[model samples]
Target: VLGLGNVGPLAGKPVMEGKALLFKRFADIDAFDIEVQARDAGHLIDVVAAIAPGFGGINLEDIAAPVCFEVEETLQAMLDIPVFHDDQHGTAVIVAAALQNALELQGKELGRIKVAIVGAGAAGIAIARMLRALGVADIFLSDLHGVLHSGRRDLTQWHKPFAVAPQDWDLAAMLRGADVVIGVSVRGAIPEAALPMLAPKPVIFALANPDPEIDPAVARRLRPDAIIATGRSDMPNQVNNVLGFPFLFRGALDCRARQINQPMLLAAVDMLARLAREPVPDAVQAAYGLTATQGLAFGPEYIIPKPLDPRLRQRVSGAVTVAARESGVARR
Candidate 1:
């Protein structure tokens, strides 16, 4: 079941219905969207716990940050089935997978690079949190006012873990010498002038929907050596959360996993990264209507699997299932 509420107008209808279709399409998992109303995390948790028993796993979607943390954490603890917040962990998993491949293509080491995230919302904060396990240490975040630092009075518990020391640094300041930029904020959050501030062969994931923080073309023009991706499908290297959730839940349910743990998530990330390097299946190429010569190659343009790739079901889900059992979360 996918828990949906508190986003746009009647979000549980359209946004979740689309996801339900994907769940059915990709993993043969029957998912339904439920609109929830609650004043606090306790109320949300109570509502989900009551209905969660009927479903194999609970997927929390569109719930805001900080509250998302409390609700997901409490619900997972209260139930034996996997409880995952797709907005937080799902987006993070895709970003981590795409970034892993991008870094590899650029010959950059995850441990030696600094990442600048331009948004402190659920997606942004979660990306920073998950990257910690991948050996990324220097992460700086920017919100509306400016850079998130120790002196900021507005830092939430979600933002504190990735915050920098008290400083007057802004986006441009943070980009200087940074090796990568992950944008989950509004368009133009990462200005063109700032692209040059990054170190050589940097990675740019301007993943704001509809419009990215920086246009992929502009970024390519300014720094030809850099590898860029956007949330837009028209652009290559779309780092989307849709590439994540269905397979993750399918794996968890197949294994009867107790909860979606870090090991399971890391396993999914690694699976996706590895999938991109393999030769593209003819079915995936034909699904996208690409001719024989215009094949999807593993490069700057295609760092993650297409949403239609059939191999994702067995490969990603199987990897997560293994991790679930090895991590002692799988009941079966």
Candidate 2:
């Protein structure tokens, strides 16, 4: 992990350490959390590349965007081994998985839903791309300014391809009648007022950590039929990257994958979604303090596998490894 200071080094350090711990605990994959003091993206890339040969894969975490984009792209191009930025792809995979199951529970198809993604940052872009790969066609993305449409002169190259024709709609307008609203934006971005504007029984993923774009409780009160998820452990259907990166890297490393490509990620999404639909193990239920009386089976509230589920490593890794081989990105 680079840029460990302003991005909350004190907070991020322990999280990275926990990720390293998960890698070892879950998959027996050895990992070291190296904190680099470098601030510049170029310098960080150089630092990571210099040590690339000693590791099987590089997991980039908590680096700020734009620079984070460059760092991951450059490293992935330069390194023979898989280089993954977990914040972008890991979050995307879990969101896709959760969204898949959420849609399934609602009897909605991925191809048919209109998804409005708030916050056109790295994670938002990655999630939109992953969902597109999963057959979601109608996706509308919004930043602070407005919808990312072709007419916007302020648009970056990264935002251009995803842009639609200029629309009169801001965030609320985009959300109106949309089947899904995914918030990768800031806290309180999705106001309570907008909840009633969405299509009935919409899947709302307010996934801003520590605080969501809109509180799930508030969303439920405003639109009782809404399927809600947040980037919070206490909340039901937490869309966490922990359900992804450890096992993903484990599979990639074990298979000697050349890269963590789209196919591999999509495969992980499929596996995660499928796992949610199966019968929950007693241990997994116990870990979440969920009992049979609580009805913790595949439903709106339990759309994705919990982070503590022991079967994740074997299942997700196996799916990812097979994808690496099938996509011809595997070296071994």
Residue lDDT tens for model 1, 29-50:
9998887767777988999999
Which regions of candidate 2 deviate over 4 angstroms? 1-5, 8-12
Model 1 ranges off by over 4 Å: 1-12
Residue 270 error, candidate 1, Å: 0.5
For candidate 1, what is the lDDT? 0.88
The superposed Cα distance between candidate 1 and the true structure at residue 79, in angstroms, equals 1.4
* Residue 282 miss distance in model 2 (angstroms): 1.4
lDDT of each: 0.88, 0.88
Q: What lDDT score goes with residue 105 in model 1?
A: 89
RMSD of each: 2.3, 2.1
